[model samples]
Target: MIVETFNKEKRNSKTVELVCDLGITGGGTAGVCAAITAARKGTKVVLIQDRPVLGGNASSEVRLWILGATSHMGNNNRWSREGGVIDEILVENLYRNPEGNAVIFDTVLLEKVLNEENITLLLNTSVYDVTKSGDTKIESLKAFNPQNSTEYIVKAPLFCDASGDGIVAFKAGASFRMGAEPKEEFGELFAPDKSYGELLGHSMYFYSKNTDKPVKFKAPEFALKDIKQIPRYKAIGKDDKGCRFWWFEYGGRHDTIHDTEHIKYELWKVIYGVWDYIKNSGEFDDVDNMTLEWVGTIPGKRESRRFEGLYMMTQQDVINQQQFDDVIAHGGWAIDLHPADGVYSKLSACTQWHSKGVYQIPYRSFVSKDIDNLFLAGRIISATHVAFGSTRVMATTGLCAQAVGMAAALCTEKGMNPADILKNRSIETLQNELNIVGQSIPNIPINSKSNLISEAAMEVSSELEISEIPFDGDWFRLNISAAQLLPFKANQNYNFQLLVKADEATELEIQLRTSEKSKNYTPELILEKQTFSLNEGEQHINVEFLKGTPNNQYAFVSFLSNDKVSLKTSDKRYSGILSVFNGVNKAVSNNGKQVPPTDIGVDEFEFWTPHRRPDGKNIAMKIYPAIQSFGSDNIGNGYVRPWGEVNAWVADLNDKNPSLKVEWDEVKKVSEIKLFLDPDYDHPMESTLMGHPEEVVPFCMRNYKIKDLDGNMLHSVEGNYQTINVFKPEKPLNLKGFIVEAEHPSEDVPAAIFEILCQ
Candidate 1:
């Protein structure tokens, strides 16, 4: 069906020319996200992946667990799951592949891409050549597929180098820097004093399976003579996998790209050596039955060449929690940097610094300065070494892909380049488009067009007047006070009540305050304070907001600790809320002496922690405003998951037929309807040490009915268990009102609907 010509050197000479709107190289996390996003937006996309499978490092070969804003549930960073496409993938995985199976996850990624009819996916195709029409424009790209021995030429208006190493940019003559930059170069506080070509290296991981009989591991000829060479080798267990061994690194002192083969060779030695030590060295004789099940042939890479862009993100931008006007994405991961020498270094494997909260990643970072139509996503995007340490993560980079993919679609529609979009002040349009697709941009509210419920009057059956939901999870401790952000008006005095349980008669202190600095969530100014003496058992206690409360926004109401008492919290955590906990770090430079005994668990506790406890146990507290459950404002707020407060349309548990009826002021034509249901965010859908949790969350609505006025059933959706559900009528529905009823809502708990959308 296809023909090819060979040159004098026997290389393929003929080219299969294909034209598309966007040509994306690489099939890694960022690349796949970019291709899928662009294709879904009606752009013709060409996704060229050099590997046989998608998901790059997350594929079965590498097997790295995807992590982003949540930062692996680290200290103080909670309720930060990445939104948009990543969230969709996670929710889907939770429903379909709860076992954390890599092969299944790969199929999910592949199906998402293939389902988009506008995408032309080419697997095992490597783009090795580029043609530049002028000094700044990319004319076309040349690629080869060894499996089929085919040579192809792809021409597109826009090209994205999602390739982890920036190969496309390198071939197109775009400026890029490899390895670490000097501290003085970008004024980066975490940069090395002297610039070096060394980079964070390549690593390989293997999986072990237990057998009924003892299995022997013979040392390969090239295996390391002594496993003690790695100081942290004692932590290795038979149950551990490659992901748990984040420090199994090598080849930072050498070229990570050009010498990949050499690096892979050395990694093999260590991987086998570690196994031999466990089985043969008498160090882990308990692993006598454990044998190697799977070994990674392709080493997962961390850092490589970083391309230059209009703006080079620096450490200051991250530490300051800068909010750029053109921000299209955000990152909450810590600035985790590994030594150039990696595992071979005498010092620890990594050094990390956390931000107060999620920080903005501007759109300027993805646009190339030298190339007119060239865009860079993934690890190659422009950023200082320290900043890259955080942005290089898969989830953050996937957000960048969504930004770039949306930008590329806009450029095609507007007949402009990346620079022109900025010049025309169309960045807001791009951001709005992103937000419409459920991407959360910090400080940017939802576009007014998609918020249809703003005008409708909402009704609920009843409210949780006195009873409180318990927020008990492993992440929450009895000693810490968890604060929920409740909405309050400026300069208004009000009464706030808390439903709490106590093991014995105890004293509790509550404080009303605001964030000391604009960037953090920790409470600072004490607007009102009160102490309560309570008896055992669950009871309601009232605290009053006297005066001087800031204008309408979230108020941080903190419930201080009584060791015998525990505040009832929702099992699920929400955003715009925070908790105070005891910290493990007691270093002097951390200003441990100055922090309030309760708030030191967070990165910026010192600025507000004035009260100290002699026992050194940080004061634990839960902060929130008065409960406004079942209020009319619940459905209008642009929050789906309960953050500081439970913002949702709820019906009383005792109601036999609870429903939320919304009547617009005038009859309107609706083409689409969407409902966001609560999936119990507290029960995370993640791959853990014990594998995946329950695939289906109990809180998700299983059966619901949609109807119009006069009790006319328009549609009935049953056995529904997704976080988000969409319905489109064959023709526009001319109606003045509609009612949503949860036929079989979760028992005992009130039926809840997060948001109702109509357009």
Candidate 2:
């Protein structure tokens, strides 16, 4: 290398220009999903991220767990996991990095983006300037990367702003709000007042490791000396690390965007001081071997600038579970808001109010009101401050961003603006495109007109007629009330027999309950209650309900808690079957039930949540007059996942070779076939810190093969663990029918499929 001679004047940085179909600012989960979805739709995308990694708050630098409607399986939302590319990412992460290492998760996000040919990822690049076309649309963006000392000018027809602070939109003169609105502004009764704080704050977390030998820690001069300043300092323990310190926050009282550095420094002081206390406070035992392993350099920001769009989501929209004609996304995370003073305030750190079910997010909330070619995404989407509390979570925002990405692709193909896609019948086209890729919209069925499978006749080897759950697993004590969720039809008398062992003679009360809403699993409406006297030894107890169900929905066969009784649990697991408990999951519900204050404008209901794998076994029981809901015809029902009913067709456990045959009247040219399999939507599959029990969900199909009418094998797959599997033959085949042969993931678990589509 040759050194250049000193010049009288400094030289400017090198400039580069790029052109693409879609340009996205921010590489958070939202931006990442937008990039992936748009790329898959044949749109050229340029993703610019200021951070070195892709996941934003979910990245290694921040290390926050990715959660969505399922809310870590702590709420009543059943099968409510966000679908589409975000679901694929979470499922893949669970299969590959079940331990949830933050660094490993970073690799997963990077690999997904890299695998897409149409995505051009530009990391460590920050957009600082925007060039406007006539003051209504963005013509191009000016960005810089200090690492490479290069300036970038990116031009695209359409742009999406998923950056947490709305950097691009802000520079482009797009309207935005940064603080809470008055109650009268949106009729939000739960809106916070001035004393309670308007904006949420930033948080920082650190990880610790235990060494076999003793370790020493010394605080720096700038470290906080008085740990008692934090009211909840006593809650910290040897195991308190990572997201457990999510409440280690500050800086809501100041500017969240411009004062980020000042906030980060204060967080560091708090972290170092807490570490120093853990090592030297002499208030606990056996912490001498603990040492600080990693500390976050940047703070995870919660609230920032929210851009205004055509429609602004309000508090009533979330609390009422409002539906929209142009619904594109859904969110179920509670209306969680933090105190303005953050860790310093004694006001419980955060307040969360949950709705009865998931709410729909409309496409109108994604298009910028002023910028013709700009789309809003992530936490920056148009939403009142009250509603933003729920939509700001990583998974929810990522899902909304997926809609933005798909809209961008549609805009590029049709040569229209973001707002035009919502006009005429184009919104339906957008929804259909999203559903084709596995995006679950509330109350919206997959109505793809090109799915030729809907015109064919289907026959299966055997359909599972659920009559019994054999006593083949462990005996779980009735320390907490437990219930088995069973799908039932209307006007059908139900009788259940459960095997239980009682320490002493006791009266076991069994209640049949169902949710007021068909699609929910809250178990609020009690249908029938029966009391049965049990003997001292193992015995079978029978309970009969002649009233039956009011509608076709899931009924809970609830066994109230009895310390003297233990119920047998079955190892058998099904796609839409689960056993829930009337217990508290402090993460979502403070108590076993949510009994909110009278004026909070939130519903009060009991949280019936399921336990994770290897623990939440189904209650061993037998039902009279077996329920026949699973049939081969369900494969073309247009629903991809369980909504108010079991939309999947499950094969009988006894059927050794389960196969499905789809036949048509005449041979048709087919090029693509898509199969929707069971991936256990109830599981949250948190991306980091919270490790999963299994690499693959128990309901996933392990192996499968496809064949034509002439018995020629088209494609075969082994060890499949994904939700949606696609098979494309080498060339289009003229076939009158096709057969699918699948192997169950396990012997006890039957093979189940949601839908099959052919084109």
Candidate 3:
């Protein structure tokens, strides 16, 4: 090969120009989702990431678990997991890597993006410059990949900045806020004061493993010499690894964006110093065989710049559970804020206050107010400092970014801007598109315009009639108050009979409670209360609520804690049915009840949460006039997930081959059908670090097939573990009706489906 050299000139790196329909920066959960969502809609997308891997904080580099509305299942937001592409990723991760190996998770994300033919992924590329078509519209972006020594000029009509710090928006001169607003500014009572710190900080984590033999460690000179310098040093132990060190934070008081390296160094010093104390300081025994297996070089950032959009979400929107007409997404993570002083300060690591239920996120909050073609996504979306505390979580931000993706696709198709879509009342069109892909918007039902099943006659092989949860020879101690959440129709009287054993003669308290808001799981309104006298032996106790339920919602049949009594639990598990406890989760709640100051403007209530499987069994009880919420008609009910009611169609436990048939008066051409199955939305499928107990959710259909009227198989799927299953024949099928047959994933759990759509 011959090499030619230029004389008296400075040569630039190789430059490549690419044009796409949608351009997204930062390949975190949000960017990954945005790219995938837009690509699936037939839009050409370019995904840019400065890091080698995707998932941002959830990547193996940083290794923070992906959590959203479910809030680690520590709050009352039941069945509130974020849906669409993120749900698919988390569910796939659980099936492929239940142990939650972060490296394996990286493969899952890469595989997902690679599977899409329309997405062009550019990794290790950093955006440094922006070219604008006008003062308010970005024309192109200039990014360089240091690893390849290449320069890229990416041009697109629409641009989304999910880059954590809003790099593109900032470079394009989009309006942004970097610090907290005062209390009087937005009337946010929970807004932090100047003394309390206005921003959350960066955190780093390290993992340790036993080497089977003694290992030696030496601290560098830069390592912190004194472990006592950390205020919470006493809380550290041999088992303190991974996210347990989330409190090992710093630099909130500093410029989070420009001073990230400084903050990272401080965190590293603290980490190494803590390790030194554990290895050489003799604070922990049997640690000689332990060694640091991995240390995150890049820190997981919590807060920085927030771009302003057409609408700014405030604390009131979250606390009041505001419903927006242009709703695009939902959030249920508590208003979690960390102290700015981080590990150095004596203040608690974080302050979290949960709302009664999930809140809607409007599409207006994702479009730039100044930039005509720009979209703000991820933690940088248009939410005030107070509201950002809850919306900043990865999964919540990912869902918001998904809305941006769909909006971009719509904007590209209609030749309109993001604001025009809202002004023209086209948000419903956007919402319907998202719902088609399995994204759950609060209070938004699946659109029936394209679903032919809505016009068909539906019949199921068998329906579950909830009459009893028979005793399975398992006894549960009444060490803590517990309640069974049961669905009831409006103006329906309910009678319950519970089996309990008493240690001695005592008074057992039973109460019927429900949330003031039907869609919420919080049990705050007590409709009826009764005190029953129990003898010294096992007996049946009857409690009746003659007033009946005020609305069609889940009512909590509550039994207060009494050490002298033990209740019976059943092994039978059903969809949309759960037993909750009035106790502390410690991770998300400090005590069993939240009694905040009156001036804080947040509600004070007790946390009623469900325990993880292998322990959270339903209470053994019988009800008069069994509730029939799981009817055959529910398959076309428009609602996909359980809202105020059990919107799923569950089959009887005795049906060996469960099936649903949708028949039309005349033959109709069907190109595709989508099935919305249950994937245990209540389970917080953390993408990393936290391991799952099952490879597939027990309530999901493991095997299913679609058949025509002549009993000919059209399609079949095995080992399915996803929430949304799409069945498309090689060619369009013309038929009068079709049958969907499915097998229960587990013998103990019955077959259930939320909604089915045919086109």
RMSD of each candidate relative to the true structure: 5.5, 1.2, 1.0
Which order, best to worst by TM-score? Answer: 3, 2, 1
Residue-wise C-alpha lDDT for candidate 3, range 1-759, written one tens digit per residue: 999877688888999999999889999999999999999998899999999999999999999999999988888899999999999999999999999899999999999999999999999999998999899899999999999999999999999999999999999998899989999999999999878899999999999999988899998888899887898899998887888788999988999999999999999998888888889997688998999899999999999999899899999999999988999999999999888999998999899999988999988889999999998899999999989999999999888889899998998898888788886668889999999898878888788776898889988899999898878848988899999998989889889888999999999999999999988999999999999999999999988888667899999999999998999999888988989999888888647888888998899988899988878899999988797899888887788888989899999888999999989999999999999999899999999888888889889988999999889998899988898999888898898999999887777889999999898
> TM-score of model 1 relative to the true fold?
0.86
Q: lDDT score, residue 498, model 3?
A: 88
- Superposed Cα RMSD, model 3: 1.0
Query: Alpha carbon lDDT of residue 657, candidate 3?
Result: 95
lDDT of 1 by residue, 1-759 (tens): 988686577554566889999999988889888888888789999999999999888777788777776654442333456667766776777777877877788888898888999999999899999999999999999999888888889999999999898899999999998877776777665675433234778878888889999887788899887877877777678678867776889988887889899999988888888888877876665787888998889999998899999999988788678879899988877677777766667666776666666789999999999999998999999998789988998888887898999999999998888877787679989987886666767767556577666777776555433233343432223464434444455565666555667788878887777654433444556777888888988777866667645555445666654567766544332222234432333211222212322321224442222111111121222334434454546676766654444566666556777777888889888887778776654333443222544566555677888889779998889877676788789999988988887753555355677777777
Q: What TM-score would each prediction reach against the true structure?
A: 0.86, 0.99, 0.99
Candidate 1 achieves a global lDDT of 0.72
Count clashing residue pairs per candidate: 22, 0, 0
Give candidate 2's whole-model lDDT.
0.91
lDDT of each: 0.72, 0.91, 0.91
lDDT of model 1 at position 433 = 81
